[model samples]
Target: MRFILVNGMALRPRILCMLCCEPIGAHYLKEFSTGLSFCGHDCYALYCGRWISRAEQVKCPAVAETSC
Candidate 1:
């Protein structure tokens, strides 16, 4: 989770992109399983294909052979 200073109040940002670490306000991508957010479809694809499980990685278009 991440917070930002707004109107002198610290509040959680509307969106926190796990891939690029950007604070996205709208049109962001979300992964339902872990409630993870990404700045865009590309970021989400990278995370979903690499950060999580092998099953998801196969579904990604840019699949690569990797070791856990």
Candidate 2:
């Protein structure tokens, strides 16, 4: 099992599912600018969706009222 460091803390590549928070395998984790660790595809998708929405909101304040 591979490990990664985030915020100066060592974290394993695998993580609990965002929905269930159950320990899963690291194979599902995707590489990102922040770090590498995601429970599964669904969780990753949800995370990415949220990030996109947030980024869009930041880029276009008319779309949504939120700070990046």
Pairs in clash, predicted candidate 2: none
Model 2 segments more than 4 A misplaced: 1-20, 60-68
Residues 4-48, model 2: lDDT tens digits: 323433346546655557775534564355554565566666666
What shift in Å separates residue 15 of candidate 2 from its native position after superposition? 4.1
Find the 10 residues in a row with the least total lDDT in model 1.
Answer: 1-10
Error of 1 at 32 (Å): 0.8
| C-alpha RMSD between model 2 and the true structure | 8.2
Return the TM-score for candidate 1, rounded to 2 decimals.
0.51
Whole-model alpha-carbon lDDT for candidate 1: 0.56
